[model samples]
Target: MSQPLSVPESHPRPALIVVMGVSGSGKSTVGAALAKAISRPFIDGDDLHPKSNVEKMSRGQPLTDEDRFPWLAIIRSTAERVCAEQAHSGEVKEGDRPAAVVVCSSLKKIYRDILRGQHAASTKMPAEEDTSEKHPSGAHLPASPALQTYFVFLDGTENLLMDRMSARKGHFMKASMLKSQLATLERPGEGEDGVARIDIDATPEEVEGAVRKAVKDMVGM
Candidate 1:
């Protein structure tokens, strides 16, 4: 049998890490780096958004709460799917799980709560729809598999973020929307669990190094 690779720490695995921030905060870069550091798979939350949401964002319009719940639901489902897939992968041994990382803006507390598999105020969710899954016959199925969800909130100054956004080429999100995104962001609270607030006011290599270390420490592994 092949030997297991060694890292500085060992996380419990089955952890869904949401690398979150507004536009140009380097969610994708940092998320990918963290996944590499952990030897896990990474998914970009932007790819989970519905086509309508993509079009809206491309037009430089900010999404309303109505436009976000469906997207967040997709993220939540994908998180569980990623962990399940990794758990059954060839390299994973019995009784061991793997972590999954994804990039998401998750600008509001309600959004973050939804990602954590917690129900938020009804007004925030789509009308008459909850996070539960249903069968083809509309029967209520069991809830999703339990996985530890964590957030790596990338915090930075508006000017710094704006500069990064402007330098990007052909990204769906526009630099003009950065102001609104900053306005929409809700920083993690002191009481929030499993969160790592990362400051991104540094170079990519520097920020990525911080992200890797922060995740390692936050996992306490």
Candidate 2:
């Protein structure tokens, strides 16, 4: 196993890490563990969902893009706030780089763009174009102190995901919706920045360790 990465003494910028995957991919479990290991705050994206969206998912219905826009907005705002707070805290030590981990599906490329402060119109650009260079959407984005975002994608076989979901209880998201969630997922491409893909077949501890190592490599921690 690889050793955990520590923030360099000279690096003070706080990073925003998004743990993403379809339901039952251990996003929440691994995300929380990663945050604790890195000494950062953790936010569960499911808690930011609107009640209507929750109800729809509880009924085993997939949420439309419209249903997700508002929830995604909330997550963006919350993450930006966390980043701002870290930035203003003043003279953070290298090992104490005030990072935050958000457990979000971020299954779509467009959603990740929004979190990264890109305009929605950029989504219409050709796949080869650098959408990150596009103008800001000026919608649902914080004013300043942009957070450098990283993504940790947890992937596994559908059968394993289904079995995990079946064993989970008391969640609004139903196991039946896993198929739709998987279909909606868009794996991060090479052009996308700061993305780490990890296989979920390993134990939760191993998964978190891999995620930490990936983040360290991405950010030069």
Candidate 3:
């Protein structure tokens, strides 16, 4: 299900917490912990990747833009579906739409833009469509925009992250491709909206605590 797309103007937006980084940066680790802390659902973005993409990664190949766009769309829709279901269940406050924390690489600016509901060349899809078509006479128009997405970047040096990836087991993304991802990564720019970075030197418990505090501070969850 698609998110409502709009909420009351007076209401604070529902948070879409995206934990992003290249492989082996503890994205799923911290995202799951944060989702539990906030009583929201957690989604592993790799699970949303297409079979072909997964296969390519397993073969130690990198995904190109053409390969990533559709997968990114799935991630956005799945997260929205979770948010819509949470809102429909009435478990959350009227306007305090519940959040969904997701782990994604979101390597490029365009990739992150897709998650943010922004359009780029050839990236146009449902995110650019109007919700008015779903309602009579556009009555449900423009009250507000909820499910605002915020990105938490897991920052670490290539050497450190590479060492961690090499020691991991059973993941499709090979350690050899870490440099490819790091090269592609455009670390959320200074002008980027709702972007924050992590302190990788901290312990696991400390990292989770820091993520929770950052999400709350950023989205008031």
TM-score of each: 0.77, 0.75, 0.80
The residue-by-residue lDDT of candidate 3 on 73-96, one tens digit each, is 666666665676676676566767
What is each predicted model's overall lDDT from 0 to 1? 0.71, 0.70, 0.72
Each prediction's total of clashing residue pairs, residues at least 3 apart in sequence or on different chains, is 0, 0, 0
Candidate 1's displacement at residue 54, Å, is: 4.5
In model 3, pairs of residues that clash are none
Q: Give the TM-score of candidate 1.
A: 0.77
Off by over 4 Å in 3: 1-11, 51-61, 124-146, 169-173
Tell me the tens digit of each residue's lDDT in model 2 across 1-221.
Answer: 12212334454665778999888899888988887777677898877665667779889787877777656665665666665455455434544556679999899998887667565443232334222222223223332334577889999999999888778777655665788788888989999988899999988778878887987788654
lDDT of 1 at 190: 95
Arranged by TM-score, best first: 3, 1, 2
- Compared with the true structure, the alpha-carbon lDDT of candidate 3 equals 0.72
